[model samples]
Target: VITSENQLSFLNVTRSLEDLPVEQGNDAEGLLNECKEAMDHLYKADVYQSFDEPSLFIYRIDIRHNGSIHSQTGIVGLVPVEDTESVQILKHEEVRPERSDLMSRHLVAVGASSSPISLTYKNDEQLDKAITNCTSNEPVLMTEDSEMKQTIWKVVGETAKELSELVSNKILYITDGHHRMAAAEEALKKSNKNYGPLESTLAVLFPDDEMLVLPFHRRVGDPEGRSSQDLLKAISAVCEIEKSDETTPERIGEVGLYLDGQSHKIILPKSNGNNLVDQLDVARLQEHILAPIFGVVNPGTHKLIDYVPGPLGINVVKERCDKDSWLGFVMHPLKIKDLMDVAEAGELMPPKSSYLMPKPRSGVFVRDLNREKNIQ
Candidate 1:
């Protein structure tokens, strides 16, 4: 969509039409025209398909990485947007208001949700039994990509009802796509429509135990005129620094620092108190090291620091450090407990605190937000 206009240009048209530049024309008028064009193209291209009957399904994903295989199974359905305050849907991360607003506008323009908000819940045995019964036969839809294999089984009639009832009382945790959930809520509020599909969002629900979290690494650049030794001395004052044999972090509160062709391990202070959010290693790094020593109070927008997801591993951090950064910190990944605790306490995690493993592939399964019914 961001490339040449000659090939697969319809998506490009949609992107360009999305929230047009001020110099182009009026946003309201331009958006209406652009959406009309995009929707027409989408309908002709069969981008959105509808089912004759409303139904839920079992969505399964199996991913292989680094000689290991991880899998997640979930139910895909519509989650009520208004139930967030009722404790049915809980979010652990904070969303940027600007991003939320932009996505809200996108939802209004697109008119249908092409992606599902990923959600997690406490394990339910009844739900698992229902899924097992449904999967006894061949999958209704199965596909494979270069990285992962996906299998989906349609659950309709009484089976769907049973599965839905099994999970009706469970609380859902937001595993990914916090922004989309926020956008859905914003759209519902702004539209002044309290019922129907406008009041609900598409989501895929999985068990919390089956999900995986990977480390999110950070790279910090030395301040002007400061050397690698100066950075190390500053960090050493707060952490126990020692030469490390490996670049990967072994445990929580332990950070692997790569500087000037060498790697060192810094053991951070043990966290105390009942606040689980403050006890997080990322939080500790921010409180004791980044803000206090490196002057990066806001890591989310700080220019001196950069984040790399865990899939790229610690090597990327080292590579970046070798070029422009003075320090590369490889952190230990967070546990599911850590996430649940922080969420239960109504606290937010630090930026880039976690990278979910076996991420669900996009475009494999999509729900039409327009298919809303009385979802009591």
Candidate 2:
């Protein structure tokens, strides 16, 4: 577990690599070199341990939120890079090319991956029974903090073989780590060798029923310096609006807008489009409110628009608005079925549409690309 109480510690570590002098003119190469050096240092310090034989691991995370516990369990192993191109693995979100390129370079330079891509699949009775049996014994390692606890158990020999076979024929959905998967694909494409360690990347597969989906709220800055009343009047032309005491949205078609230290309820009209993606609440917010009112046509890269995770609570959004003079929108969480339907239909969701909680922690199961055996 990350011992540092500061939440930005991981970001700080990454930023140090990117904060190079402009005069260098080769910032990307310098960043990769720095990553290689860091990995080398960690290796020298013996921060990673290797298993004696091929095995799979059971990873479980319990997140405590608002007096309730949300638990999820999954199997940790390597997924073939080719699966990303086929129907075996599906992605719902579009990835930025620049970010994908940078990740590709990092993976090649370090020769290891600390983070595991998260995948979800339809629940199966046999797989559930297998996971339950594996987790019944004491965990090989356990770690915890105030908000969450993580445990891991190693499975080997025949049991590992059985678990791998059970999931082999099932189709998987990419719930998180879209960019990392893209990076792995890009790396393989650029490489000359057809089959090797680069053929697969690390991942953890969880059942769809146990996955937790949360809303990804939006925050926008008014570039025209419009007052809260003027903006509200513009929004009222397209949507039904009224002052509200609640800061969180109660339903799918409703949005809680915080502006000028007051909360307003925004009732969105039905989407005229026929696609499943257009019917989403985030899509409605972008189409009716963000684009028309704020002129933010592209929410993904717009300078005036930003995304906030729902688990951070509405107070964090309000505090940010109070400090920066920005407006916030609290959105309702999306259902798991909605996500699966959109993906199965071969459609893409809006950027930053969902925030999945209790993600697999980094550094828990490191994969050495050059030395590790291929899973496929």
Candidate 3:
């Protein structure tokens, strides 16, 4: 946690999340760390992470694809984060503590988050119409997601009345940013006399009908770690390999591994592997291929292998691998049902495997966890 015992005031900073300023040269992890540092540097941060009830946040993700307009549902409220034997909140992704610890340290010190974890709940048709009636008039923040237009509005007054009434039966589930939520839990645990077991951090809540899930594509560096032959051999045990004298994977369950222009499809065999996790595409690549042939255990955290969200499609992957003949894997996006099932079962998906969007850009919404007491 960033120790705000220094110059920044932890509370009452700025408004209009976009006006915060410009940033560059940062991957997802780097950008979040930068936000933590910014809060500590510019705002009065706290020495300890005090316990504040998790509050609902009115969020919006405006997407403009072609001529169509899709406005995402956003909510504001306190979420429960506790280490109870029976966990109330469910999560789809697993959190790495070290990563979370870094975020917690930053958050506790500066008391600000760069982004809201994107989460969706079981679909409630009734709730959908009410939320729409409230948000249709105006929006809080209207921005762009890649080429899609994005916008959001805070729910208050009459609008809030509808939200407050609807959320009574709401059971929030986190779809992404598992690490960030874990860090909040960690920070609360290490706080002063003010620590509370259940406090909601700012999150974007949407019903099952309104939720969108995207698959994340995987790429590996040159065949240096594993010779092309060894890699093919390992993949062959699980998949049906079709040697391509050409380039790229052309179909589903087909992955293209290229070493300096030599491309092949690392397709899995008809027979499925045992164990749910091992059966996954990412798992097969790691266990049979990456570890045995390439010697890389956690490709998720690997610097050489980059991940691209499926929505961006394969063009970006082609651009990244063109120079060195990098290996690119195309995956079918995970179904929403699978994501929720895993989360409810308390299992974490492979890191970087799921990319849920449209991502809620930080600075668009500012949540002062430190000032939660005065909110009422």
RMSD to the hidden true structure, all candidates: 3.2, 3.1, 7.3
Give the local distance difference test score of model 1. Answer: 0.78
Candidate 2, 151-203: lDDT as tens digits: 99999999999999999999899999999999999999899646488888899
Clashes of each: 0, 0, 35
TM-scores, one per candidate: 0.90, 0.92, 0.73
Best by lDDT: 2
Candidate 1 off by > 4 Å: 1-36, 47-49, 272-274, 369-376
The local lDDT score (0 to 100) that residue 172 gets in candidate 1 is 84
Residue lDDT tens for model 1, 128-203: 7788898887787888878888898887899888888899998888888898898899998888875467787888
Alpha carbon lDDT of each predicted model: 0.78, 0.86, 0.61
Our model 3 lands, by Cα RMSD against the true structure, at 7.3
Pick by TM-score: which candidate is best?
2
Alpha-carbon runs more than 4 Å astray in model 3: 1-58, 64-71, 83-86, 140-148, 157-162, 168-170, 192-198, 222-234, 243-252, 256-259, 262-264, 270-275, 302-304, 374-376
Q: Candidate 3 lDDT, tens digit per residue, 178-260?
A: 77888887777787526442265666777666666666777776446666676666667756777686444555445566554
Q: What is the lDDT of residue 8 in candidate 2?
A: 26
Better of 1 and 3 by TM-score: 1
**Span of ten consecutive residues with least summed lDDT in model 3:** 10-19
